[model samples]
Target: MRIIIVDDEMLARGVMREYLAAHADVEIVAECANGFEAVKAITELEPDLVFLDMQMPKLDGFEVAELAGGKTRFIFATAFDQYALKAFEVHALDYLLKPFSQQRLDQALAHARASLAAGSGQRDAEAAAVSAAARDVAATRVRPAERVLIRDGARVHVIPAEKIEYVEAQDDYVQIHSDGKAYLKNQRMAELEEQLDADKFIRIHRSYLVNIECVARIEQAGKDSHQAVLHDGTRLAISRSGYQRIRAVMQ
Candidate 1:
C-alpha cells in the first residue's frame, strides 16, 4: 500500500519512513512536516494510507481527516492521550502512540491489512454483498447534527450546524447565517460543500448554500429559477442547473 507520513517533528517522520521502507507491501510515497503540507500532498499524490500526527501547527489530525473526506485511510500517530476519543470520531483506522515499538507497528499493519482485505472486491456477488454490508454499517454510525467549528476573527468558535439557516458567499470567504447573526469564515463555499453532509445541506444557488432542515418552502420564481425560503425568513435564489439536485432530496 502507498503511504504518506505527516508529522511536525523530523525524527518522527524519519522513524516512520524507515519502518515502512522495510516492509515490501508498504511504500513511503511522501513525508509532510505540517498539516498544510500534508493536505496539499494528499490531494496531489492520493496515497492509500497516511500516518498523521494528532497535534500540529495550524491544523490537527482530526481537521486533516475532515478535509481528506475518506480519500485515504488515516492512522493517527500522537504523543498525547487527549486525542484518542477525537481520533475515533473521524473513523481512523488505528491510533499509534509516540515512542511506539516495532511490535506495535507490526500489529497495526496487520490490522490495516485485514481491513483492506475485507473491503476488497472482484467477483460481482462478493462485491455486492460487501457493498451492502458497508452501507448498512455506515448508516448505523451516522452522528446527529451538533457543533461546527467556525473561524471567528483569529479564534474558532464551535457552533451548532443545525442552527445555521443559510450560507452566503462573499468573495473568498463564506458568511454563515445563524441565530439572527452572521459569522464570516475564511473558507470557500465549494470546500465547505465537501465537508458538509449532503442529506442535511443543499446547494440551492451558486452564491448560496442552505441547510435542508431550515428550508421552509420553495417558490417558483421563473421558468427554471426557483427561490427557497428558509425557516429564519432568509430567501435563497436557486438556478436552473441546481434545481434537479435539490428536487431529488425534496421528494
Candidate 2:
C-alpha cells in the first residue's frame, strides 16, 4: 500500500519510517513536515493511506482532513489523547497515540487494509456519513470557529470568521460574503450557523446569516416584516423570528 507520513517533527517522521520498513508491501510516497504540505501532497499524490499528525504548525490534522478527506484513508497519529474521540468522529480509520509500539502501528495499517477492501460502495457510504458527522461535530464543538476552511478543487480558502459579513443560503450551498468577495461553500445554512459564533453572527432570515457588527440598523420593510440594513447599504429581509432574535441581541 502507498502511504504518506505527516508530522511537523523530523524525529516523529523518522520513527514512522523505521517502523513501516518492516512491511515490504508498504511504500512511503512522501513525508510532510506540516499540514499545508500534507494537503498539497495528498491532493497531488493520491496515496492509498496517510499517517497524519494532529498537532502541527499552521493547519492541524483536522483541517488537513477537511481539505483532503475524500481523497484517501487516514490514520491519525497524535500525542494528545484528548483528540482521540474527535478523530473517530471525523471518521479517521484509526488513531495512533504517539510513542506507540511497532505492533500498534501494524494494527492500524491492518485496519486500513481491511477498510480499503470493503468495496467502493461501502467506502462511498462511509465517506458520506463521515461528512455529515464532521459537520455535526464542528457545530457542537465548544469553541466557535475562528476561521472557516473551504476546499475548492485543489485550493483551500482560509477565511477568517470575523471577516465574514454575511452568509446566504443557496440550496445545498452557502455563499459566504467576506472582504467584498463571495465564496461558495458546500455546507448547510443551519450547520454553518451553529459552527459560527452565536454572539456575532445572527440569522436575520431563514436564508440569511448576517454579522451583527455589520448591521447599520433594522428597518421596517412591511407592517410586521423588517429588513437589516448593513453598513455597506445592503438590505436583507428578516423573518419574524429572526427579527426578534436580532432585536434581543441588538438591545
Candidate 3:
C-alpha cells in the first residue's frame, strides 16, 4: 500500500513517518507541508491512503478533502477536539488524535486495511450511515466563519468575515466585495452561505450574498425585481425571497 503524510510541521510529519515505518506493507510516497502540496501529490501520485492533518497552512484539511479525497482513503491526524467529531461526520476511515499511542495507530491502520478490502456494498452502507450522522449534527455545528482565507498566486489573504459587503458567484468561484475592494476565492457560493454567520450574511439572490449590516437601502427595481444599495453605493440584484428575508429581519 502507498501512503502520504500531510502536516505543516516537519516534526509532526517525522513522528507519523517513524510510527508508520513499522508497517512493512506500506510505502511512504510523499510528505507534504501544506494542503497545496498535498492536493498536487494526491492528483499525481494517487496514493492508496493518506494521513492528513486537520489544520495546515493554506487550505484546511476539510477543504483539501473536498478537492482531492475522492479516490483515496484518508485517516485524519489532528489535535483539534472539534475535528474529532467532524471526522466521523465526513466519513473519514478513522482519525488519529494527536500524541496517539502506538496501539491507537495500529487500530486505525487496521480499520483502514480492512475497509480497503471490503466490497462496494459495505462501503455504500457505511457512507449512508455517515451521511445520516452528519445530518443529525449539522444543525448544532453551524459555527460562523470568523475569517475567510483566499489564496492569490503566492499571496494569502485573510478577510474578516464581518467586513464582507456582499459575495457574487463567478463560475466555480466567488467574488467577495468589501470596503470598496473585491477578492476572489475558489469556493462555491452555497458553501460560503452556510458558513457565514446567518445573522450577518444572507442570500439576497441565487448569485449574491449580502452583508445585512452593509445595506444602505433596499429599493424595488421593477415589478418583480429589487436592488440592495450598499454603503459604498454598490447595487446588487435581490430576489423576492431575498427581499422578504431582509424585510423579516430588518422590520
Residue lDDT tens for model 3, 1-251: 89999999999999898889899998999999998888778877889889999989888887677667455678999998777767766578998889898789989999989988896777888889987876676657657878887756545566899889899999889999877889998878987887899998989899999999999998989998999998888899989898899888877
Candidate 1: stretches off by over 4 Å: 120-251
lDDT of 3 at 229: 92
Candidate number with the higher TM-score (2 or 3): 2
Give the winner by lDDT: 2 or 3. 2
For candidate 3, the per-residue lDDT at 189 reads 92
Q: Write the per-residue lDDT of candidate 1 for residues 3-32, one digit (tens) a residue.
A: 889999999988888777668999888899
Candidate 1, clashing residue pairs?
none
Better of 1 and 2 by TM-score: 2
Q: What lDDT score belongs to each candidate, Candidate 1 first?
A: 0.76, 0.90, 0.85
* Best candidate (score: lDDT): 2
Tell me the lDDT of model 1 at 90.
57
Q: How far is candidate 3 from the true structure (C-alpha RMSD, Å)?
A: 3.7
lDDT of 2 by residue, 140-188 (tens): 5899889999878777889999999999999999999998889998878
Q: In model 2, which residue pairs have backbone atoms overlapping below 3 Å?
A: none
